[model samples]
Target: MKNRNVILTGAGTVIPWGAPSTDKLTDILRQDSIFINDKGEPIGEYLYSLLKTQMGKRRAYNTPNFESILHFIELLFEYKKSRYSMSSSFFRINDFFLIDPEIQNKLEIYESQKLDKRLDTSFGTKRLIANEYYYYELYLHFTFLIKKEIEKYETVEEKYHELNKSFNRFLHQVKGENGIVRFYTLNYDYLVPKISNLKFFDGYDEKTGKMNVKKIIEDDYIDCYYHLHGSFKLNFIGEKSNDYSVCYVQKNFVQNNLIPSNIITGYNKPERILNETFYEFYQKMIEDLIKANKIYIIGYSFNDMHVNAALKRALKKGSAKITVVDKCSLEDFHLKYDKIIDSNPDYDMNKLIKFPNTYQMTTEALKAKAYLNGLNDFLDNLIRSNN
Candidate 1:
C-alpha cells in the first residue's frame, strides 16, 4: 500500500515542447496565415468581431478565451443542427445553403421539383446563409494551431535533450522495478509518448487505432495510460443507443488522416465530460484518487470542480498524501483551493498541504513539494528497502 503512486498531469506539462498556452495560441493565430471563409472573410476577424460584440464596448480589449470562443462555435453548430432537424412542411430547410455552389447551379433546373430545394433566388427560396462554413474554418484553425505547435517536437531541439533524457531514465527505472505509474493527463499533446522508454499502452490498438475503454480498464495495474480529456487523433465516430432495451446509449470516437483532431478545449469542459467518450475516464479518476497512497498533482490549476471534489474526498479519508508539483507557495495554494477544502469537515488542509519538511523539495523551497526526479528516488528507495 505504501508504494501506491499516482500522477496527474495538466496543460503545463507540455509547455516544454513548445506547446502554446491559451493566450499564446490566440496571439499566434492572429498573425498566422488566416483562414478565409466562403465570403472571403478572415475567420479570426469575423469571429473576433462577434466575440467583441458579445463583450460590449467597455470590454472590447478583453481577448476571448479558448473556452468562450469554442463554446460559442459549439453552441451555434448545435443550434443549426437542432434547428434544421425539426420536420415541417411550412419551413424550407437551409440544407442546400452549405452545398457546393457549382452543384447548386447544376441542380437549378430541378430546384422547384425537388422537395429539398436549393436556396437560390430563381427558385423563390431565398439563398439565405448562416456563416455555417465559418464554424468549421474556425475550428480547423484552432486544431491547426495546436497541432503545429506540438509537432515542433519532431525536430531535435538541442536545448531539451537533457530534459528528455532525464525523463527516459525515470521511466526506464520504473519499468525495471515492475511497478506501473498510472499517468492520467488532461493535455492532448503526444509529448509523453515521444519520450517514453518504458512500455506504453493507451487503449488504442497498435495495428488499428481503435480505442476500447472497457479493455483498458481491465488491464489496470501495468499497462495504464488514460487521456482524461480528448486528444488530437480522437474524433467522434458513430452513435450507439442503449435504447436497444430502453437501457443505454453509446457514441463512437473516430479519427482519419485528413482530420486528425478532436481535443476538448474551450469552455464547459466539466459539462462536456458527460458524453460517452470521456465519461469513463473521469469516473476512473475519482477511483484512482481514492486508491492513491501518494498522489502527485502536476501543473494543474484546480479550475475544474469535478476534479477538485475528487481531491477533496480523497484527502478527507486521511490516508493518502498529496504533493502538488507546481511552483505555487503553500500559502498561495491554500488561497487557491480553500473553498474546496473548507467544505469537508473531515479535511485538515494544513496536514496534506504543508512544507516538504525534508530536503526532498524539487523546484523551490517555498513553492510546491516533490517532483519527477525526487519521485523516482522515493520509489527506488522503497524497492531497495523491500528487497
Candidate 2:
C-alpha cells in the first residue's frame, strides 16, 4: 500500500563528486568570455570585435549583455510555437529540418527571408552567418566538453542500464495493485525517460496512424516521468520569432537533419510554467502526485520559489507522507522548509500536521537505510511494517 512519488532536482543535489553537471557547462559559457583584459581593464577590443562581427548595421537592443542575448534567443523560439500543437509528424519535421544540419541550412535560408530589411541586407546576412556559426561552434564545443566530463564518470548509458536493473528489481519485489512509479526531476537532461523506457502520452495509434485521446497502456508497467523545471530538450515556441521553435539537438534535430543546438538558456522563468502547453503537462503531473500515498524528493535544493509554491499547493490538496533524500542534516532540512512554511501565514508551523510525516537523509544513507543490516535493517523493517 505504499505509493511513492519521487522528485529529483538537478545541479547541486545530484553531485557525484562535489560537482554538478553545470561545471561542465563552464567552457561553453566562457567561450565568448566577456571580462577585463590582462591590463586590469575591460576587454573593449573583444567586445568591439564581437559587435562588429555579430551586430553589423542593425541597431543594438537596449540590453546588450550576454544574458540579454541569450534571453533574446530563447524568447525568439518561444514566440514561434504559440499554439502548443503536438504532432509526431511536426515533431519529426522540426527535428529534421530545424534541429539537424542537413535541414538547418534550408531553415536558415527560410529564416533569412523573414528578417527585417536591416537584418536581410548584405551586412546583416554576413552578421547572421557569423552569429549562427559562432552559436553552433559554441554548442558543439560545450557538447564535447560535457561528453568528456561525462566520460570521467561511469558512462550515463551504463549508469542508465544499471538503474534500470535496480528499478526492475524494485518493481518485482514490491508487489501491489498499483504498479506505478511516479518520477519527478529538476534536471533538464533526458536520461530518465531514456532509462525508464517511457514515452510521452501522445495517444498515438500505430495501426491506424491516427491521433486519439485514449491513453495507450503498454505492458503491465507504467512509469510516469515528470519534469519539475521545464525540460532542456522540450521544444517550445520561441518568444522572438514566429517561424521557429526550440528543440532538442539530438532527438529533434541531429537525427532529423535540423539544427543541433538549444537556442535558449536560463529556462527557470515563471511565465514558462504558465505557458498553455506546459501548464497542462504540469497539471497532469500534479494530479499524479496528489494521488500518490508517499512522496520521495531527491536531488532537489527546494530553493526554486515557483516549484516550492507548486509543491506546497499539491501538499495542501493531499495528505501524503513525504521523505526528503538530501545530503543535509534533518535540522537543516527542517529549517529550509521552515522558511517555505513561514512564507504562508495560513499554515502554522506548530500546527502543520504535514511536517511530522516528512523525513530526510542522504542518498547513501537512504540506500543503507533500505538495504544494510543492523540499524539499517531495523529502520527499513520498521518503515515497511508501519506502511
CA RMSD per model (angstroms): 11.3, 14.1
Can you give the lDDT of residue 21 in candidate 2? 46
Scored by lDDT, model 2 comes in at: 0.39
Query: How well does candidate 1 score on lDDT at residue 120?
Result: 20
lDDT of 1 at 88: 31
**Residues 1-387, candidate 1, lDDT per residue (tens digit)?**
224556787775665556677677665554443444344444454444456555674454346765555555544344334445422332221121222344234223222221212322110122122333444334545655665665675345778776677666655553445456767888766677767765667767666565667666776666356777766555443112111112122222321011112555655565557644667778877877788766667677677677778877777765666666544556655555564564444343443423343223433322224433333344444445457
Shift of residue 230 alpha carbon in model 2, Å: 3.9
- lDDT of candidate 1 at residue 378, scale 0 to 100: 42
lDDT by residue (125-233, candidate 2, tens digit) is: 2122223333332333333344344334323545445445544343333324554666656554445444433453322244553322234223213455545454333
Backbone clashes for every candidate come to 7, 28
